[model samples]
Target: MKNPNGFGSVYKLSGNRKKKWVARKTISWENGKQNRKIVGYFETKNEALKALANFEYIENSKITFKQVYDLWSKKHFENIGHNRATNIKSRYKVHLSVIDNVSICDLKIKDLQKLYDNLNLSSGTANQIKSILKMIFDFAIRNEYIDKNPIDYLEVKKHKSVLERKIFTSEEIAFLWNNINLKLVDTVLIMIYTGLRIEEFLNLKIENINLEERYCIAGSKTEAGINRLVPFNHKIIPLITKRFKEKNTYFITCNNRKISYSTYRRAFIKLMEDLNLKHTIHDCRHTFATLMSNAEANPASIAKIIGHKDYKITEKIYTHKDKNELIKAVDMIN
Candidate 1:
């Protein structure tokens, strides 16, 4: 009986040899020549044929990330409550979706690390996502889709306390300015100059920026913060202009896509570690507040600029005066 095309072959070699039956597969072709690999040399044709069959079966059975996740969740979901299962599914969609079509064998630690580092998740949420990945890799290993789990090598560091208002010193600010070309340092500089919350800066859209006027409208997380006008610090005008010209929808981005908060947080942490600076993302806001206060900038303007609705007088009364005050306050940061 003839074998199917590309199924590989088992045949006896002409040379005198201890094991004459050879099983080989054509892996590639170059210069009109077949580049093949011998699976094995066997004592009998049947043995060689069996080896080829096993090789083909293994090659054909390689599973993808999505496939293994589906298989794993079937039994996993059955054992857990519907709500818990749904929550796992949600995390998988948000965090693991990037590698869905990737084969389990091809998935690498760096691939996982890139995704993990880019997210701005809390420690609990980060651990939850990591758990889901660990389960999928374990499933793959048990099923023989892959031998080693890449997740075993990954290290997820604990998040620092963001509540600590440890502001950057003038010396550290000078150091950052000198090293502005470093990755994400510009982001930190922007945060310091503009006094934006991490999320607010990340969500700043192109439409909200006025490059000519040197101001942007952005805010969130509070009634006072919503759509407030923020004047740009003179030092960061070039930085903002550079980002604006990228034509991205958001002012801050990674690979032309909206960078998630958790990813940025992780990268920010790494940056701090590299620079040997002890601070949090929220610290940039604190630095701004401190800079403004130290400069003796107007309290009304400071309150408005930082999006605090704490002024005794109604913000409606100072709206016109505050715009000029906000610009003046930003300039005073020097």
Candidate 2:
């Protein structure tokens, strides 16, 4: 007897097979051809019939991986911090391209494992990808799109990192100091002397600087760093005063307006090109830390001034120290 239309079919295959009964369904059609998909196999006709009846097809609603990710990230990105959301989006855009268009319901552990194994990234980055996949799968499951997450079984391989943070050498520092009158060179000196992260420096407001006290209350990225008092080195005091007198809302400005990192980055690239220096903006912070350590600044003072929450400093020294001690530490750099 013929089965009802669109109900799929169960039939027995030719003799040598152990699971002779096959369950098949018409998943799609193209150019007058029915694209039959194999649902599963069974040892008996009744078993195949039961399996076919129980099998779920994505005929009505097809949810692709990208679709789920879009839905998940739409609400998810709003609640998380900007940096974290940017990192997640970057990983998704760069690394998860393979499964982007594939239907979420069709994904399996082998596919996920293959995707993970093919990536050659740092352990932290690779693990982040795994975590992103897991969250997407969990979203699908929550929405009744899939019964289980394939990422649960997928394993990521870790690779050793060779990347190192390079700092400005003493000679390079001298070159910068001598050329400080050049365009945007003073900003580099400010970053180096104060140990401000690139973001913190870009976001520094004029109101935060106390010219007489010679310190700026500014920070970001970590609890220890936020709204902290960072004393200015005497060498950059002239530079700071000049910038402060500009009367712009932010101390760091270009053409009488607040400057952005991208704009500053382009200018920095040109400056580096001219000076023959190979360094990133963050390296200024590294140079500051190195200089302070060489001057034998207290470890706790270093951590406190830099917004790092070192265990030893946090437990023993950072709590007891005050702004005066930090000022003493800052003065040790030069």
TM-score per candidate: 0.53, 0.64
Residue lDDT tens for model 1, 1-334: 9999888888898888889999988766799888676777898999899888876323414667887898789869999986588789879988888888887788889988878776677788888888889998887777567888888888888854335579999999999999989999999999999899998998889989998887889978898889999999889998887778447798888788988777788899999999999999999998998899899987778778888887566777555555666887899988
Worst 10 residues of 2 by lDDT: 311-320
lDDT (10s digit) by residue, model 2, range 1-334: 8888988998888989999999998877899999887877889998888877876565424778988898779868989987688779878998996778898888878878887887777778888888998998898777567898888787656766645679898889999999989998999998999999988998898888898988999878898888988988888999988878536888887677877666787799899999999988888999999999999998888887788888354546685778788888889976
User: Which residues of candidate 2, in runs, are more than 4 Å off?
Assistant: 1-64, 78-83, 98-108, 118-122, 141-147, 156-163, 178-185, 220-226, 245-249, 253-281, 309-325
Alpha carbon lDDT of residue 98, candidate 2?
70
- Quantify all predictions' global Cα lDDT against the true fold: 0.84, 0.84
